[model samples]
Target: MADATVRPESRWYGPLAATPRHLFVPRWWSPGERDGTWVYELRDGASDPDAWMSCAYDKSLSVITRVGPHHADHAASAAVVPEAWPTSSATLPALVVKLYQHAFLADDSRLLVTCGSGYGTALACRRLGDGRVTSVDVDPYLIQSARDRLAAAGHRPQLEICDVTGALPGVYDRIVSTVSVQGIPASWLAALAPGGRMVTALSGTGLLIVADKTADGGATGQVAPEPAAFMGTRHGDDYPPAPDHADLWATARKADGESVTTGRYPVMRVNSTWDVRSTLELTVPGIEHRMESGADGTRTAYMLHPDGSWARATAPGARQVPTVHQGGPRRLWDELDRIRTWLVIDGDLPVAGAAVRIDPDGTCHLSRSGWSASIGAQ
Candidate 1:
């Protein structure tokens, strides 16, 4: 290990500087290894500390420690090498601190946290003592690996092999989820001691929820100022194939009987940002968007969901007329059009601090900036 650039003299700088990132992320992967059966490799930085320090401090990169629910141990040795999409990582230290700050962890508070690489759990132990943290993960491999890592470092945090999105085992003053959730699990609320706070991200968006547990088997909260990313909840190692592509193409690019429109917003990049994606997901509900570019010059974007809702747009050139087709009781394009209209009139649909209400059955209600919607069971 080498000297770190994350400053120790600064307030949050202590953990960044003190924690050894190189240990957390000894290896990573890239796109080329998508087909390879084996991935992962060891870092050769014992000979070059400066190179290691640079990677340790990079805010944009996450140290990949686990993949496809397979931790580094059971995963192939060289398979951890830089190749396919990084399935899981020890999120950068600064982001972890920010999430902890959002959680408002106090010395007296016991926390139930989701474990991935054990980096976050270590930080919580450093902040609130090892006994005050309970970490859970769905994969036994992850929990076991994290436990070994913590034990080797002389830290004994509570580690459990449990599904984070389902029933959590312990009660705590606060719950901080480093994983995104599809819904606010009722079990989490049940595990929270009365008035406990939870800081978590909504699956598929950059939305950070800050809610306090209520007595009536429900919770209420608004959005947070900072945006964070966490691996989405998983039932199995990988997510089931999102609605079949053939079915998407079938309803999305229909032959006849639909209205068309020249969209007002010309080809906005709705793919990257969380705010835009979350808004679209809320307004458009179940529709899934697809973007394509032809070999020649045509480009198309399609939205298809299980509700028989479909919307498609074809553009020959940027800023040109985009032929659109739509179907379903809730015209998906019209909803996008409404969002665009709201953007034009008010500049943006309020996302953060959008009122969230959860019932005993785990249904979520999202309302903000005058648009209200509900999400039922998956």
Candidate 2:
């Protein structure tokens, strides 16, 4: 929150200093897990100035604006919403800066940026001038509100309400997205000016892909070493309700599956580790992960796929191996173990800095060290 010492001393600094993030997000949601229930706590800047300043200026924390269909600005002061997934937010400042830095923006660069809370767009406008920045979002309200806020901050950039994956508002020298996509949209390739670059994270994983537009309307680049997570782009007011996997949840929590094996390692919350998790995600996308621990020092982990594949693993403690149960078409835990074994043998996963070749049709092929994987259009 207090980073006075770390300064890049570029055009961004003056804009970052001039633009107040709090103005764009007067009220936002801060998430917390309590009693196994996911809760969104609304924080009002007017009521709690100290808390607002602490979080608003913090360089690493994202302030959620919309959770599901609920927007914090519309919520009652001090309201807490239970079991809501953040749909929109003002992304962490440092990560925004990271995306911009990866873009390698020149002073004269024309940028097409995504508008969430519009804080990032404001920063871009500050750096490249309002005339060179075009900001778009799927939510019409977000676009209008952000336009007003940017004007209040003494800047006005082109703002439009448009789905990011469909068609961009304009051709640009840089296309930076805070939203995640399963694969680079074909429309993006057509819209990007030649020699322009794009920076975005792949959906369901923390892989930050940096690619430059190629002569063939495709792109080729390497995955960044660092990890970043962003909400997937949404077309509707809310993401579809997650599948009701009551039977699968019960089986994963208590029932034994077709086969049981002693795991080679302890219960691992694989989703917590970016490298392994990203590799597993790259190998098998759209798998949901969950983990819980018992009072008796027992740990349990579950993996569920929309295809009805499920796996459960339990361990006694950190030192003891887990007993795994897998069912459905795929042995989910076994696949995870196979990936881990590969990592053990190679000392690293290919997902780290893998070569990314995105086709004109939106299929992405990632390869490294003789390993290969692909993400089809979502």
Which candidate tops TM-score? Answer: 2
On residues 43-66, what C-alpha lDDT tens digit does candidate 2 reach at each position?
Answer: 899999998888888888888999
Error of 2 at 47 (Å): 0.5
Query: What's model 2's lDDT at 132?
Result: 94
Which 10-residue window in model 2 sums to the lowest lDDT?
A: 1-10
Cα displacement (Å) at residue 69, model 1 = 5.2
Task: Give each model's whole-structure lDDT.
Answer: 0.71, 0.87
Where model 2 places Cα greater than 4 Å from the true spot, the runs are 1-5, 33-36
Q: How many backbone clashes does candidate 2 have?
A: 1
RMSD to the native, candidate 1?
3.9
Q: What is the C-alpha local distance difference test score of candidate 2?
A: 0.87
